[model samples]
Target: MKTFYKYAAFAAASLAGLCACSSDDDAAETGSGLQAVAQPQIIVSDLTTSGFTLRWEAVDDAGSYVYTFDGGSETPTTDCRLEFNSLERQKEYVVAVKACPRDPAEYTESPFTYIHVLTDDLEQLPQPKITLGSAYASKTVISWTEVPEAELYEFSVDGGEAATTRNRTVILSKLDKGRTYSFSVRAMTSDATRFTNSEAAQLSFVTSDADVPPLVIAPTTIISDAVAFDIYASSDETYYYEILPATTFAKYSPEELMTAFQTYIVEYAKKQGISLQLAMASMLKSGTQSLQMTGLTPELSYVIFAFGMDLRGNITSNLSSTQFKTTADGYSAGPNYGGSDWFTQRFYISNAYLAMTGYGWTNSVWTHWKGDDVTDVRYRTLTTKLFNQVFPDPYDRQAVAAFLKDPNYGLQFNPALLSATVNSADGYNGLTEGVSAGTSYTLLTLATSSSGAETVCVNSVTTKTSTEAAAWFAAAA
Candidate 1:
């Protein structure tokens, strides 16, 4: 009976222990359910040219909220707001916030919130650096380094936006005669912010005087008949051409020429305080001779005298004289062929034929009747017939035109006709082969008429017999 009592007591102890463990678990669950977590809201405020401030609503149930600027290290702010300074210009920044729970056992954070900041400070733009290159009388080219984050450059001639752009350089042109002008520059970063204007960079340039000589084309001598030298004025300003005296060309030694050029350039530069490089000279050409410049000014009239100078300092007197007006505005010469008579005649003939035939000749050869192609068989036949009718013939323009337009002939007739010489041993003997001779005879008959045509026929026959005899003798020998 005692042993049975002992077993019952042990069972009761085990049951109590299990009940205690279950109660402890229930209590823990209830405690966890009572604890609360907090969420934080971020807001951006006080946007300024320098920087921006950020603020947030703190969560009541949270232990602390951490804020970060642009994904940087987190910082703790009790009032949920902080002021950040010295922000970059025209740049975007993100502020992030996260809430942390107070309970050590139940540590959890709310979702992160973001705030953006922008600054409008212009000091962040790069400083302007100016470079002056290639200055001439009445004009100067100025280049500058580009400013970072700048949308457009504000250029001032004297002090204005008359010339402004992203282009680092601009050409200043058209200044008063013998007067100088100053230039300055600045940059615009954004629609709202513009950097302080840079100090004025002085580029003074004077307009060339009326007496200043124009630029001369290089190598002086234009040897190629196909290429004509350009006579460009230093500027787009109005200028005229005048014939320099023949004596001037002969009297001016190399040193004199150099001195003259340098003196003029220096005078122009000193007036403007800017460098000037001679660009080119303007001259008029007539026949094979050219007239040197005599005078140049706006809307001025001048006479040009043609003259030549030998390297030995011998000058040819003025060969001819012509007058021209200085154009009101700058002008460029049109392409010219130097007036080659033969070339001009050839061009005229080509153009006239093209107008008549509706097709231009290609490289001196008629396009429609070219090469050995059979497509021009009609042309060949026409030409042959025409040549046959014209050989041993007198000159007849109408007959020649008719023969050319005839549908049965080609260019082969040209060679045949050219080969027909009365002084030759063959005379008109070979002219009878194919239509060449026949056309020559017909042309001769038409040109001389009746009795004259009959006489020509007899002469042609006699010439043919003589040619045959000559050929036989030569072959026999």
Candidate 2:
């Protein structure tokens, strides 16, 4: 079986050689028992930029044949068809196919077949150039340069469906305000071929008018560490503030004034939160007397000012009188009083005496009462005597308690009263060294000073008001 198979393969090889030699037209002279004729013919049926397929009529008794393709050396094809890969774009390719019969007895030369494949010439359209025009009101217009081979131009705004048109420009209307729009254009060929989109041209426009002025609400006065006035404003427009130093009067626009007032009130409120309102009220009521109101809760400083404005747009500046602060309830000694200690001591003694003789007193001789002694006749007599001597009345104890809780009472002497002097070198020079009449005192002294000569002369002495002085003194004690 192996020998027979080898013989069959040898016969097939001989027939294939005969077919190749026969196509060269000199097989008969070579004495190889084969006749040479023309190369097998190949007709190209389909051609593209990538490859081409060649088909030809089959030869009789042909086992296989070889053919040349696209100027390449001859290559064999067993099926009488040749496919040339890697063809150039828009170029022509020459192709041929040969066949050989497998039966040696029937093998003969067959005519050569020839075919040429030509790739179609495709002209790519140039990129379209887009130009976005300015937008007005509710409309925006866009224009673009036309592409030479473009069958249709495509236009789109912000990735929306593209509008097809042959014209170089298109107008889009009914755009929303404050919305941004992007325009793009592309060119397409007649055969449904599309080129890359052109460089996108973009222009953004906002549809808001800047002609309106912001609205201003009424002004408000914040009585605090500093007299701050607040004004409220409302509008779509942006606003800024201008702080007026002394009064609500301002040359700035209403918006500016409102902003300034608002800022002042906020700051003043923060400073006055810890201060006693009574103290502030008293200072203001001093009526132009240079009263130094100081020793306030350092965190909360009081301010003296008149009226403020309400939301009604009416200015209440003159309508409401300026408010002042008085001493706290526990420290309510009159301004002339130095400090609360004198008053507090008196109250304390009075309260102690009342407690001894009040309704709950057990003995009059001040001796401790034993278990059964509470009902003894001697204990009862002593209790009555003590009650009459000490309490005498319940009102006295109530008054003392009330005095202790007075808001005007301060632990320290009011620094506001003492005249302030920046320098205090000499004991007496007819001029106090440091004295300030404002809420706080500062001492000042000229440089000239000697030990015993009294060269340290003080001038411009200021003192705290009576109310402030009393408050400071009480608080210090």
TM-score, every prediction: 0.21, 0.21
What C-alpha lDDT does candidate 2 achieve relative to the native structure?
Answer: 0.35
Local accuracy of candidate 1 as per-residue lDDT tens digits, 63-154: 77777778789887566777877767557676666666676466445545555545533333334545453234444556564444457877
Residue-wise C-alpha lDDT for candidate 2, range 174-274, written one tens digit per residue: 77655666666666555422222232344444432221112212112111122222222222222222222333332344444545554554455457773
Task: Work out how many backbone clashes candidate 1 has.
Answer: 27
Indicate which candidate wins on lDDT: 1
- Candidates' lDDT values, in order? 0.38, 0.35
